[model samples]
Target: MNQSHTYDDVPYPDLCYAYTHPGRIAAIATLLGMQPTPVENCRVLELGCAGGGNLIPMAYGLPNSTFTGIDNSARQIEMAQQKATALGLDNITLQTMDIMEVAPDFGEFDYIIVHGIYAWVPPAVQDQLLAICQQNLAPQGVAYISYNTLPGWHMVLMVREMMQYHTRKVTDPRQRADLARTLINDLVQMIPESENSAYAAFLHTYADMRFDKLGGHTDWEDSALLHDELSEYNTPLYFHQFIEHAAQHGLQYLAEADFTQVMMHDLPENTQLRLQEMAHDTIELEQYLDFVRHQTFRRTLLCHESVDVDRTLRAERIRHLYISSRAVLLADNDGNEYFRTHDGSTFPAEHPLTTAALRYLSQISPRAVRFEPLLKQACARLNLAQPTPEDAHMLAINLLQAFTYSLQMAEMMTCSPDFTIEISERPLASPLARLQVQIAPLISNLRHEQVELDGLSRAVTPFLDGQHTLPMLVDELADMVAAGQLAPSKEHATPEQIRKQLDHDIRYALRWLSRAALLIG
Candidate 1:
C-alpha cells in the first residue's frame, strides 16, 4: 500500500509532544547561544502533522504567531480543519501535500518540525527533508526532527523481525497487531527466565513496557503500533550517519530536543574525561554517547551549518529567560532537605537564595516567573539587602546544573493566554481544553502537557464556561444524575446526600483543574 493510503486507512494518534513545542525549541536554542526567532511571533511549519494535534495548541498559545501544518493524508487534514474551524483559530493553516512536492519556495519558517517521519519515509524523501530545511528555514531558524537510532534499535529490530514474520499473512491492521502481540507474550510465557538466556529477560521487559503503554487491552494503539513497528519502511540509522547526511545538505546538529538525555552530568568523572578525549568534535562526542547509552530513539535539533552555535551554557544566558520548577522538597532522616524533580532526580537545597527561588517556582508552578523578578523575590524572602554579583552567579550556576539534569525548566518566551492559578466564583478553562473534553479524555492543557481527565473532571470540564456559580455547577451535575446521564458513585443515596457529594466533587474538580493550568481567569 502507498504511504498516504496507509495513513488514511489507519490514522496516526492525535497527540501533542511537549518537547517539540516551539517554546521548548526556542528555550534550548537560546541556551546554546543561538539567536532563534522568538516563539511569540515566529512562523512554524510541521511536516507530517497528523490532524494538527501538536500545531493547533501552539497557535492558540501564541496568538501572534502563525502556523502551517501539511500531511499527505487528506483525511487527517480534514480532521484538522474541522477542529481549527470549531476553535475559531484563524492563525493556523492545514493542508494535504506530498512530502516530495514541498518545495523550499513554499515559504520560510522560523521553526520547522518533521516529527516522526524521517526514518519512516523513503531515503529520497529523507534527503528532501534536509534540502527543504536548508533552503527554506530562516537564518536563525531551528528544525526539529525525530527518528529511531542505531545500536539501541538492534534488539528492538529483533523483536520487530519476529512480529513482522508472525503477522505476515494477516491483512487486517488491527488483527495483525493482535497477532504480533500474541507472539511476543506467548514467547515470553513459553520461555522461563534464565540467567543464561538474555532473550527471555528482554521479552519479559518488552512485554511489560507494551502493557504499560497500551494498557491491558491488546487493541489500544492498533493503528499506532501498525505504523510504528509493522510499517514497510522503518529504518534505523547511526547518529553519525544522519549528521553526515545533514551536513551534505548544509545543516549541522545543534542539540537533542530532550537535552537532559544527552547530558554528561551523571557520567563518572573519568568516563566523561575519556569520552571527551576520544572525540575530536561535538558531533563525535554525541555519536560516542549514543553508542554508550545504546540509544533507541532521538529527537534532534538542527541549524544552518554557517551559523555559529555557542555550546557553552553560560550563567548570563538564563538572565532573560523565564524559570519554573515542578520539584517537591523532601527531607532525609538527618533533616537535610533536598528537591526531587518530577523525573526523580534529587538536588541538594544548600544555597539559601537558590532554595528560596525554587520554593517560589514550586508555589507558582505551571506558571513561569521571569529571571530578574524571581531573583528579587528570592532575595526579599531571604531578607537580604541587594543581591551581590556573587549571589547572582551562585544561583545561576546551580539552576543551570539542575536544568541540564532536567530538574527544572527555562523558557525564552511564554504566553499568558489570560489564564491564572486563582479559581474564580464561576471558574473557566481554556476554550481549547473545554472543547477537547467533548471529544476525548486526553486533552491538552495550557502548558502543552497531555492531561488525562478522571471521570468526574471530564464531566465537569464542559460546564466551566465562567457562566455558572457553585450552586449552578452542582445543579448541573445533580440534573445529569437525575436524568441518568451521569451515575452517582453510591448505588443508592438520599437526595440530600447526593447534593452534598455533588457540591464537594465539583469544588474538588475545579481546584484540581486550577492547579493543572486549565483554568482561565
Candidate 2:
C-alpha cells in the first residue's frame, strides 16, 4: 500500500521524535547541573525541529518556558505552527528558517534542544548551530544534541548498503521499505536455520524484526534508511573531538545523558581491563573505548565556556534524586536477583517476593515515603526479619532504574506532568502519585477563579482532560501558579477541600466540553 503522503518535504519533527534517544535531555540537565527552569519565563529554542513533535511536547510540558522551533522545511514548520494553534499553546513559536540564517534576534535561551540534525546537515550548517549555541544559550543553560555514532552502526552499514542497492530500483518510500524487507527476508530464508549458524541466525533474526516493523510511516522508513546509509558523520567521535568542536564556539561537552553508556560497563570485563591498562587519560579512554565497542549514538550536553562547570555551585545543580519505576526483572535466582535495561524499558521484579513488595508499594499510593520505611514494610510482608544490605541495595537500584526509564519515556512521549520522584523518600506510593495529590487542588482553584495560571497548567491540561492521574494535572497547575499567572485561593482551601473542588471542577469542565462536542471521549 502507498502510505499517505501529507507533504513533499520530509517532515522533520516526526522523524526526529521517532529516533530521539532516550534520557538525553535529563542527562544533559544532570551533567550541566541544571534545574528545570520555569517554562513560562525561560526562552527555549530547537534547531532543526522538524514538524515540532518533540518541541510541542516540551512547550506543553513547561508552560513557564517560551519555545521557538526553527526548521529548514516550510511544510514541517507549517504543520508545527498549525498544531500549536490547534492546541492553543501560545508560548511556542515555529518558524521556517535555516541554521545558516540563525541570528541574534532569536534571543538567548535557557535551553536549546537539537536532535537528528547534526549528522545529516552540512558542515557549514553544523558550524552555524555551534555559533548559535555560543551566542544564544544562557550562561547556565544547556544544549541537548543527539547524533549518529560509529562502531555500532558499522554493522548497520552493511544492511544499509544492501537496502540502498535494492531500493535504487524502487521509487516509493513504502516500496523501498518493502524491498529492503524482502531482500533481508530472502537472505534469511536462504540460510539454514541451525544453532551452529549463530551469526547467520542473528542476521536473519534482525531481518525478521525489521520486516515486521516496516511500512508504518513514510518518515519512519525514509529516515531510518537515510540515517543508515549516510552515517560516516554519524559514527562515534572522540570525546575530545566533540569537546574541541564545542570549544571553537565556546561550548564544552559537560557529560553524557546515558551515564552508564559512557561508563562502558556493559563491555566484557577482559576488554575493559585491557583498555583501562592501555589508556592513560580519561578523554582518551572514553574515545578509544567507544571506538572499540562500536558505539553508534550519543546524547551529549554542552555548556558555554564562561560557565564555572567545576564549581561547587555547579555540582549542586546536578539532579541526583530522580523518579523511576520497577520495570526490569534483575535476577531469576532463588535468593539472588538481577536485572538489565536499555534505553527506556522499566525494571520488573523477578519473583513473587518482589511482586508482593510492589503490591505494598501500591497501597501507599501517592505519598512520598522514606526508602527505609518501604524496605521495612517489604521485609515484614515477606516475613524476613530485615532486608540485608545487599538486598536493600539491589532493590533500590532496580527501583531507581525503573523510575529513570519511566521519566525518560514520559519525556520522550511528551506526556504530561512528567512523573518523577524524590529518591530520599520511600513513599507508600510512587512519588509521581504524591506530587499529584499535593498539586491538584491548587490547579482546580486557579481554573475556577479563571486566574491566569503559569504555563505549567496549560502544559498539563490536555492530559488532565480527566482520565489520567490527578497529581500530574496538579503539577502542571502548580507550575502555572508558580509562574504567577494563576492566583492562590482567597478562601482557605485545605488539601482535602482542594481535591473535592478539583474533582468537581474537572467533572463539570468535562461535561460542559463534551456536551458542546468540544471534547471527544
Q: How many backbone clashes does candidate 1 have?
A: 0
lDDT (10s digit) by residue, model 1, range 1-521: 33222777887777788878887888788888898887889999999998787888888888889999999899989999999999999999999998789886899999999999998888999999999888889999999999999999889899988988888777888778888888998997677554456888898788677645634334436766788778888899999999999999999999988888778877799989999999999888989999888899999999999889999899888776777778778899999999987667788999998998888888887677778888998999999878999988999888888788773543334333346889899888899998889875378888887788877888888988999899999898989899998889787997788889999988898888988879986
Q: Tell me how many residue pairs clash in candidate 2.
A: 51
Q: Which runs of model 1 end up more than 4 angstroms from their true locations?
A: 1-5, 192-197, 214-220, 407-418
Top candidate on lDDT is: 1
After aligning candidate 1 to the native by TM-score, how far in Å is the CA of 516 from where it should be? 1.7
Error of 1 at 489 (Å): 3.1
- The candidate 2 region of ten consecutive residues with least summed lDDT is 442-451
What RMSD does model 2 have?
13.3
Per-candidate alpha-carbon RMSD to the true structure? 2.1, 13.3
Q: lDDT for each of the candidates?
A: 0.84, 0.54
Provide the lDDT at 506 for model 2.
45
Quantify how close model 1 is to the true structure by its C-alpha RMSD in Å. 2.1
- What would the TM-scores of all predictions be? 0.95, 0.61
Q: Candidate 1's C-alpha lDDT?
A: 0.84
